[model samples]
Target: MKFSPLLAELINALTCLPGVGNKSAQRMAFHLLERNREGALSLSNVLHNAMEHITHCQRCRTFTEDEVCEICRHPEREASGLLCIVESPQDVLAIEQTLSYKGQYFVLMGHLSPIDGIGPDEIGLDKLESRLQEGRISEVILATNPTVEGEATAHYIAQLCANASVDASRIAHGVPVGGELEYIDGNTLTHAFSGRRKV
Candidate 1:
């Protein structure tokens, strides 16, 4: 049976999310229509509100409603002497879940991928350079994933830090090869952060 045009569009949009295939989308559409139209409307409202209100933090670049994120604005968080670098805000959340790090963060928003023409400036490295020159950070922990692009990005940042005479280190071996920090367990991530070594 053919779905209505509106229903088809909604199902297609649902399938745009990662891991949601056409079949799943169709099932979701049917379930939402059959069981709870209000639930579907609520989901739509949340998505629209988040997209409209959430934005990158000024200091750390994590998504937030105001100029700075809760982490950057928090007086209790360690403000000086430590900076953890991660590819995305999600990675920051992943590390935070471990509760092992209390320092600041620098979110790159993306990894350096020469093949895809993504450069340091494109990933907010220039902004990071200015942050480093501010003289508040004592150490920079490169927490990029273990992928080829991730490693290359980390090495590039390390070189930059060395040239500027800033202390730099990479998260240690607890993270498996080809694994993303977002996927790593909290314990492993904590161990990696604690065991971080100079690069």
Candidate 2:
């Protein structure tokens, strides 16, 4: 139970990862120190580099080390006139895994929760408004999670899209209520994307 100060610090730092508790973090720290220092060093380097260089894409707000993400730079994505809005970058990866969508994305980084003090501007809705006003996208897909907060965020964005005179839709069908896009299966994601309903 009594670890060296540095080891304790390593455990605490590892616990910052999602689902990694104190016990798991201790195991990881111990494993790294005892068996895989090289791998741990590699992980540290990559993490440091990612933190230093990764930034949001100017156009869509997804993580990118460059000025804009590859998806945003793709001409076909703009030509398609379709934009899928997601709560996080993980959801973008999940949807991409399904290979059923070939459209642009707008990552909110978080959903709207008024009690938490996250409003339209907090989640970058002002940037989204600017993007919508550009008029390149003809349809906006509300791909937020099915949680109550996610629903609220989707409805808010739908209203924004409507105000901009762009068609808006919500993904449904195989995706169950309260399910997150990051955890949903590929078939369900594909079905949900394919069966999107007008918002």
Candidate 3:
């Protein structure tokens, strides 16, 4: 039997999420329509609000509703002068969960992927260069993923730090090669963040 047009459209929309295939989308759509229209409505409202309100923080480039994120505005974090650079905003959250780092962050939003046409400018490197030129940061800890593109991005940023007379380091312990920082366990990530080696 064919699903009604609206139900089919809902299922198709649900499939847009990563890892949610047709069967999963159909299951979710049916579950929402069958058992929890109220929950679905609530989810829809919250998602709509977040999509409309959430934006990148001005200084760190992390997702926030404000012009500057709380972390960037914190006095202690600013005084610390330590900057941790990551490939994505999710990485910032992952490192925060480890509770081993208390410093400023620069979220690239993506790595340097030439094949995909993503470059330094596309990932907010110009803004990062402006921040580095400010001379407020003393060191930059490269917390980008262990992938090839991540490494390349890190090295490129390290050069920028060098140009700005800031120390640069790469996270060097516990994190496995080729693994994403977002997926690493908190303890391992903590160790990696704490054991960063000078680049």
Candidate 4:
């Protein structure tokens, strides 16, 4: 029952993905190897290319190749008095699928987890503050998840924005309590954005 070094390495690499344990990684490796070499190659190529091109947007921390994301640079999007703040790029994607929002987005990239040593600056709150100071945005919608950490992070950001004189609000109801935005349906996400409550 000895495997080649190459196969072992493949399993180890697959395990690097979040939630992929040793057994799952081994299963994936064997499944990919047994079915399609081209699929595995395609996955590798895409991962490498994405790693090279995907970078944080200067304005919003959302992943993009350019300085600003398509959402931020789009002229059709509402330029004044609107903003949606979320915890990660996936959350942004989830909301985008709803097709109800036509405003800019600011991705926090993470929640405030003090035990994990993640603080405000580490999550780029200062950058957000600077963006607020630019004096064009009037309403900021905090779209962070409904978890404890996410709520705390939203409250912290809302307080910061309020102190700087920007109107802030949290995502409206419809998003389930103790649920993450990624799992929410498109219609629900859209409804949440439209019905956001002032904080």
Candidate 5:
């Protein structure tokens, strides 16, 4: 009739994950406890290790163990002078898989949401502005999601680039409105990146 306190706590903890509701969390808890304790233990270890060691890359704000991410550290990528900006690290991986872009990336980690109290500084826009002011970036490609918040964030960054006299462009709508870059098809993402236009 009722779950044990420890099982209920496990289910509640699982619900902290995005998109995971009570039913799904219960299912996951049961699945792990009954079918695969070994896998669950491994996942727990990995999650704890990552949370302790991973941090935002100083330059791009992507997750990394070092001061800078591998992309920013790569000497060959620095000379390209092109920076593609996206909302999260997942978008970075998505664009990289397309192989249509050769430049480095700047991850916002999130888009602007005034109602949620997320602002420019909250999303690290000031750091991005400083990077632009360095005058090394020849072009900035906005690859944020097509959602309203993403668009607003892009426009804000575009203005920041304009103030610094750097070129700013937005990826094409081949991504579809309300779509996230991480879910877009590789071919479509390639087309969007190639067809980017000035904002």
Candidate 6:
């Protein structure tokens, strides 16, 4: 009934991933050891490299190996002057997959949670404010999730935009309440982005 120390360590390490519990971690560990050691080694190598090299984009705060992410570096994207603000990188990917948006992004990386000690600065709002004050961004679209924390973050951003005299808009409610952008279909996301209204 006892797992070897190495096996136990593998299982415990795997559980560090979000939504992966002990049983799932155990299964993953066993599968890697029994059937796919090569794939597991490859994954381990890539994880190590990424952890060492990947960092937040200086401009958008998205994960990247360079100072800025590819999206921010793209010439056409910067020229658009429209900024889509989202709580996480996954939301950016979700919107990008729809091909519905052609603009830059400012990723918060998380929603505001006062109880959890996550504040405006914790989510990179000062960086966002500096970006807004630079006057290159013409419009800011709030594509944060429909959760309470997401709404609060969006409202705060809207106020910031107002203070800076920049236009602010919120994506439509096509996305279900309490739903994450990553879970929404491409068509629905397109509709939501297209139907965004000034806030």
lDDT of 2: 0.93
Backbone clashes in candidate 5 total: 0
Clashing pairs in 5: none
lDDT of each: 0.88, 0.93, 0.92, 0.89, 0.93, 0.94
Kindly provide the TM-score of model 4 when superposed on the true structure, using C-alpha atoms.
Answer: 0.81
lDDT of 2 by residue, 150-183 (tens): 9899999999998999999998658888988899
Clashes of each: 0, 0, 0, 0, 0, 0
Task: Write model 1 residue lDDT over 1-199, tens digit each, in one string.
Answer: 8788999998999988999999999999999999999998999999999999999898888788899887887765655578899999899989999999988888988899878889998898988998888887789999999778998999999988887788999877588879998989998898788887889
Candidate 2 local Cα displacement, residue 104, angstroms: 0.4
What TM-score does structure 1 among the candidates reach?
0.82
lDDT of 5 at 196: 77
Which candidate would rank higher by lDDT, 1 or 2? 2
Best by TM-score: 3
lDDT score of residue 115 within candidate 3 = 96
lDDT of 6 at 182: 94
Query: Which runs of model 1 end up more than 4 angstroms from their true locations?
Result: 76-78, 174-199
Q: Assess candidate 6 and give its lDDT.
A: 0.94
lDDT of 6 by residue, 97-122 (tens): 99989999999999999999999999
lDDT of 1 at 117: 89
Model 5 Cα lDDT, one tens digit per residue, 1-199? 6799999999999999999999999999999999999999999999999999999999999999999999999887899999999999999999999888899999999999999999999999999999999999999999999788998999999999999999999977677779999998987788788887789
Using lDDT as the yardstick, the better of models 1 and 5 is 5
- The segments of candidate 5 whose C-alpha lies over 4 angstroms from its true place after superposition are 174-199
